[model samples]
Target: MTYCVGLSVDQGLIFMSDSRTNAGVDNISVVSKMKVWEVPGERFLCLLSAGNLATTQATISLLDERGLAPAERNPSILTQPSMFQTAKLVGETVKEVISYTTPAGQSADAMFSGSFILGGQIKGGKPRIFLIYPQGNFIEAGADNPFFQIGEHKYGRPIIIRTYDPKMSLEECAKLLLVSFDSTIRSNLSVGLPIDMQFYEADSLKAGYKRRFDKNDPYYQTISEGWSDALKSAFDALPPFER
Candidate 1:
């Protein structure tokens, strides 16, 4: 399994994903689940994927191949005029890849399914983000819901829910997500790191900060340990319940 999140704040967008995939406890490996595409001043796209590794990789490869030769492939991801259209193209590609992999007449099984959190900005449009499902359908982030998370999401969702704010700065958003990711990592074995994170500043039309956090990263270590101690202190500060 994996964990990926796309958050939208007033300052910009943030994307993050864990890098562990395993067939069994004995067969574990690390592979990046993040893919990024850019056209300099024209557009910037970031994709965070979850679910079957084979399905996700194939879908991305097809998109990348088409993007590389847009003339022959027709509508390339890079050529989309808006973030909405780009998301639709990704959903279609995901559906096509899954359909081809599943046996004829048998519905696409869970083993062959994948999902994505797609976020970016097209030259003439404001930044946006979408959660694309396995059925070739998607929902965009908006005022009410400014973020999306996929794969092993439950373990890390509460923190985001309690603290997310539309007015958060890009750096604050990154810190919040790392705390969320740290919470998830402590509780789930399937979602191990090095975590990949990317930032896109509002109206920048280009990528912003990007980093990968491995188990030994100094900052990550600080956050992880600090959160644990903070949680204990918060618990102790609570009024005791008298039976």
Candidate 2:
């Protein structure tokens, strides 16, 4: 399992994902779940994936090949005129990957499973965000819903709700994501470290800030330990319940 989130902020978009994937309790490994594709000033796209590792990898590989579609006018990710078109390309890719991997006679639920968070911008458009479902359809982030999450989402959602403000600056967006990720890591072993994060400033049409936070990173360590202590101290400082 993994934890991935994409935030639709005023400045642009913030994406972060944990890298851990496991076939069983003992069969665990780290694989990058976040992907980026760019064309300098024209287009920039990033994908955050969660579900069956093999299927997701296949989808990413296919997207990397460019123009797998037969239609001459079907704009590929790199050539799409808008972020919405880019999302349709990704959604179609998901459908293809699942079709190629799902075994005959197996139920859809039992066959392939995965989802993606697609966010980025094209030269003439504003940054946009979409959450693609296992069935190859999606919904975009809106004013009421400014973010999307995939895999092990429940544990970390509260932090987002409490701290998220659509108008917050890009740096604050990054900080909020890290705080939310920190909460997820402590609560679930399936979601491990060496997290991948990318921040895209609106209308930049170029990838701006990118980072990776690992297990031994000093600042991450401080945040984790300090937050734990602060929570315990707060609990203890609260007035005792009626007795």
Candidate 3:
């Protein structure tokens, strides 16, 4: 399993994904679940994937192959005139890959399924984000919902729900996501990390800062340890229960 989040704030977009995949407790490995494509001054795209690793990787590989041979493949993700079209293309690719991987008479929605959180900006349009389902349909992030999370998301969702604000700065958004991830990592054995993060500033039309946080990263250590202590204090400060 994995955990990936795409957050949209007034300043820009923030994406983070954990890199752990396992067939069983004894067969754990790390594989990045984040894919990024950038066309400097024209657009920037980041995709956070969840679900079957084979399905997700094949989908991304097909997209990359099509992008390089655009004259043969009708719509390259890089050539899309808008972010919406780009997301549609990704959704289609995901559905196609899953269909091709599934055996005849078997359910494509079974082990072959995958989903994505697509976030980016194309030249003329304002930045946008979409949650693309395996069925080739998607929903956009808007005023009411400014973020999306995919994969092993349950353990980390509450913090984002309780704390998210549209006015948050890009840096603040990153910190919030790390805290959310830390919570998830502690609670789930399947979502271990070396987390990958990327930032895109509003209207920049290019990629911003990017980083990877491993277990030993100093800042991550600080956040993880601080959050544990803070949580214990908060619990202690709450009114005691008495029957």
Top TM-score prediction, candidate number: 1
* TM-score, structure 2 vs. true: 0.90
- Looking at model 2, residue 12 earns an lDDT score of 88
Give the per-residue Cα lDDT of candidate 2 at 30: 86
- Compose the digit string of candidate 1's lDDT tens values, residues 127-175: 9999999998999999999999999899889989999989889888878
Model with the higher TM-score, candidate 1 or 3 = 1
List model 2 lDDT by residue over 22-84, tens digit each.
877698998999999888988889999999987788888777764454544333567777878
CA lDDT of each candidate? 0.91, 0.87, 0.91
Ranking by TM-score: 1, 3, 2
Give the true-structure RMSD of model 2. 3.4
Candidate 2 residue spans exceeding 4 A from truth: 66-75, 105-111, 233-240
Among all windows of ten consecutive residues in candidate 1, which has the lowest summed lDDT? 66-75
Model 1 regions lying over 4 Å from their true place: 66-75, 104-110
